[model samples]
Target: MGKSSTSVLVILAFFAIYVIWGSTYLLNKVAVQELEPFMLASCRFTTAGILIFILAKIMGIPLSITKKQLWNTIIAGILFLSFGNGVVVWALKYVDSGFAALEISAQPLIILLLMRVLQGKKIQPMSVIGVILGIVGIYLLVSQKQIIAKEESITGMVMIFFCMLSWAYGSLFVAKADLPNNYFVNTGYQMFTAGITLALMSLAFGETWSAPLSWSGGVQLSMVLLIVFGSILAFTSFNYLLKAVSPEKVATSTYVNPIVALLLGWYFLDEQITAQSIIAATILLTGVYFINTKKTLAIFERFKR
Candidate 1:
């Protein structure tokens, strides 16, 4: 691909990740009302995993890997897909889509702290301030009675918090861990492993499989959306961006997702955007800027040497 073409693809990929993946939050919220949440996620991922595996096979992309690489990918899949994404899917059953988006926006803040603690990365002064500001924003956003007062919703929030932490750690791990370079292979294994784990969990949890399909059209549509938009398109673009952009730049999508999700929620569901949400979004985006943009510019300046 030419440089311009690559740039355009990157931009498109970012948009897919930002907009499509963001919309999944609300979709999940609506879908869960008609389906078992974990089962819903398992079905989505299983289908996506199968499609990716098929694509990889048809393209003759090497899917075989060393034992070490297999183990690493499996671990990442468990942490990211099963725990991280699974939690969010389950939470949608109890939380509003817009509120869920706000809570999930905390991932970048979690990533900053995890990098400093786990990877021995320096916590820049501005980044520290950003984390603090982001947390305050999340607090304000989630303090609404609609979000916090419901016991099931509160449990969902806690699960989502852990989900963010797991996902943050998984991202850093992917950066540092030895793995295959082919995005298809890496993503294929991750989805397959995650899908299997989630499916098993869903079965163990006694999620009934006897439910009629037509009665759950919304859930079926949500699953299709997740597989096509969320898993296949968004994920592939994101992994491609990882190679083309700085890790920090790729991380910016985390912040961008909530903005997209909030907007989509308002448009489709007529969800109100409150002053608290706007304020929280500003703080969160500002924090993401500090964590990603400042560091990226600093690194580029050093590269000019």
Candidate 2:
């Protein structure tokens, strides 16, 4: 693809990822009302993974991966999808999707700090300040008495925190590891490996797939959405963007995702967004700016070699 076409693809992928993944938060909240968390998630992703793997192979994207690469992908899948997504899915039972997305929006800060510690990458001072600001903002937004009820909300927050941590660590590992050269192949490996891991865990827990036919309607709809848009479309678009844009540029999607999720939550579920949420959103975005772009831009000259 030409540069202009590639740029457009990246932009399209970025927006699609932002909207679709953000929309998932509310869907998650609704789904958990009718289905068990891990089991539902396991079913969604396993089906999606299988579909994507088959499609990619049919499209002539190679599925061959070395043993070491397979192991690395397995580890990444566990940390990123199994634990990270699993936590988010579980959190929906205790917390509203809007609330969960707000907490999850703090992921960029976590990722930056993880990069610093694990890779010896030094963040700009402004980025550090941004992280503090984001944390304070998130605190203010979620500190409401009703929202922070002792057992429920607190547990949800804990889940979100670990989810963020696991995701960040896994992303860092993917960045450093040697994997398949083909992005499509790598994506297939990721989804299949991650989905299988979760599926096995679901079986170990003896999760029954015996929902009534009445609720099967919603289950089928969720399954379609998860497979077509969430798993195949979003993952492929993301991988394409990874090739098209710089990593730092692609990371901007993190900032965009929460806003989309907030809007979707409000529109669909009638979720109320108070002044505190507005302030928290601002702080969180500002922190992302510091952690991701502001410092990098300021220090660009030094690293331009």
C-alpha lDDT (0 to 100) for residue 9 of candidate 1: 90
Worst 10 residues of 1 by lDDT: 296-305
31-128 per-residue lDDT for model 2 (tens digits)? 77788777777767777677767877789877788999989877877887788887688888887778788887777678667767866778778777
Q: lDDT for each of the candidates?
A: 0.78, 0.73
RMSD to truth, every model? 2.7, 2.7
Residue 11, candidate 2: how far off, in angstroms? 1.6
The estimated TM-scores of all candidates read 0.90, 0.89
**Residue-level lDDT tens digits of model 1 in 1-305:** 69999879988988887888888887777777777777777777777888998998999897889999999888988887888898788887776787778887877777767766865667677777778988898888889766666899888888888888888787777766766688777877888888889989999899965454664677667777888888888877766765666555566676778888888889987888888889988888888767665664475334322
Candidate 2 TM-score, true structure as reference? 0.89
Best TM-score among the predictions, by candidate number: 1
